[model samples]
Target chain A: MTQSAGLVAEAILPTFTEAVELHKSMVFSIAWHFLRDRSRAEELSQDVFLELHRRWGSLRSAEHLVFWLRKVTGNRAIDMIRSRKVRPETSLDAAAEPTTLEQMHDSLLASYLERMVATLPEKQRLAIVMRYQEDLEPDEIARILGMNVSTVKTNIARALSLLQAKTVGRLQPNTARRLNEMPGETGK
Target chain B: MTPFEQELKRALARQQPSADFTERLFARIEEEQAAAPVRWWQRIAQWPAQTIWALAPVCVLILLTSGTMLYTQHRRAVQGEHAKQQLLLALRITSNKLQATQRQVNEVESERQPNQKDNIRRLL
Candidate 1:
């Protein structure tokens, strides 16, 4: 190892470490929300950080670094899912339901929705995850995903509509009647 | 702000990875950095070592192809030589048989000539 290159790597090491420390939440959360598996998410986020460290020179600013992290992490997650052909354990249509809306706690409902999101087509699932998890705009997601803004919006909208329909329309028989009778029942 | 969309947002909100996530990441980073080539010379030195596996099959393929080609040419040459030797032997055998037949014919003619001479001498 030459002295100058060793010095360069040593100098850049702290910056890379700082980047990982600062953005680990965002990067880790993206994988977790997408894959819904903690170990896999952790493994994937480490890989992303390693990649970020490798490409540190190309990144221009803090924002660009974040952008790079998001783009790479999202793409990697999508690629992993595609390669594994991994899907949610059950489709909303096929899952056997023993719990009613009233019986499902808030976290349980959230879990259900998260699983349902996993069942969504890849684009729609990613769109939903980025929008809700990262709070990214449709255009921002479009830029990250290399899709038209309208396409991103369509994916999010369709995913939301599917979630709402599956959650609301499939309520218990008496629960649906009671909820329908008592309220405007927009179910939005 | 609808209840369901809000619920969706709540469902999808980002959560930090496990508490040791950063620690594990840094540990791995440090391990990789330690293992990685730190300089241009180091990279050059490691290059062949890394790619030796990939290059091995190509080298084997080249050797196999060249060996087959050389063997095929040598076999063809050997076959041609064998055919030529067989042809020469047959020609030699044919010449020898023709010469032997000619010698026999000459001897028979000589023997007949002597008999004719004797008969003529007797007649004289």
Candidate 2:
């Protein structure tokens, strides 16, 4: 009995550590995107990981691990929003500063689109950031934010409208044409 | 729900975190694990801390309420004691006046008795 118990404990220990490492990117990205600052995101992400360590026993599977992390990140962001007496200025759609992507020749239109997304309301901003920036689906965004499917849809809709409107006058004629050439640029 | 939504997703997915994220996270995690297991008391201290936090306001409220009640009662008792003393002093003064009036009446009666006795002897 003792041998079996020890084996089980040893087996579970590595898995817990592996789980934290595996989801760190997704967790950190969510926090950073919501907070719009790297340092705060890092701190928040560390808090989430610590919480995950504390609750390791209750999580049953890999899928549950991702679900819990995403959900907690969203809830924590919202809690941060509610609890804070002062809100710092954040530009959601702003392109990441001077990264390889910005230096690359391709996707200038996409960069413009990001700047437009930054002006959206916090909820809409988070939804769009998670959906597009993190490649999360609407349903997944709903799960993370603890909102119903329709509300998530509304947030996405409002975000896209804002992006489209902002992009119309900002992009040059050729870049605008290129953006419109994209498949989802126009209504069906 | 429109096509623009899809394009927005395509645009945003290109952004990624700095490459060193995984390496940093592992280093932090290992450092934490190598450290000592938190004492059981530390693990459980939040409950007691929260209990004390929650109880602090109630304790303050009870102290304030009891203090106010005791102060009011003390004031009322002092006032009652002061009124009783004044009433006793007033009664003492009234009793002394009454005693003085009685002594004067006794003196008058003695003087009137002597005058009446002389008149009666002369008439006999």
- What would the DockQ be for model 1? 0.18
**Tens digit per residue, CA lDDT, model 1, B5-111:** 66778888777788888788778878998897578754444343326567779999999999999999999999999999999999999999999999999999988
CA error at residue B84 for candidate 1, angstroms: 62
Poorly placed runs, candidate 1 (over 4 Å): A1-14, A172-188, B41-124
Best by TM-score: 1
List model 2 lDDT by residue over A4-111, tens digit each: 212233232336567655566677667665666677677777778877776665565566666687788877876776677324453444533344432333366554
Question: lDDT of model 1 at residue B85?
Answer: 100
Candidate 1 chain B weakest lDDT stretch, 10 residues = B41-50
Candidate 1 has an lDDT of 0.74
Interface RMSD score of each model? 9.3, 8.2
* For model 1 chain A, the run of ten residues with the poorest summed lDDT: A1-10
Model 2 DockQ (Cα-based): 0.10
In model 1, which residue pairs have backbone atoms overlapping below 3 Å? none
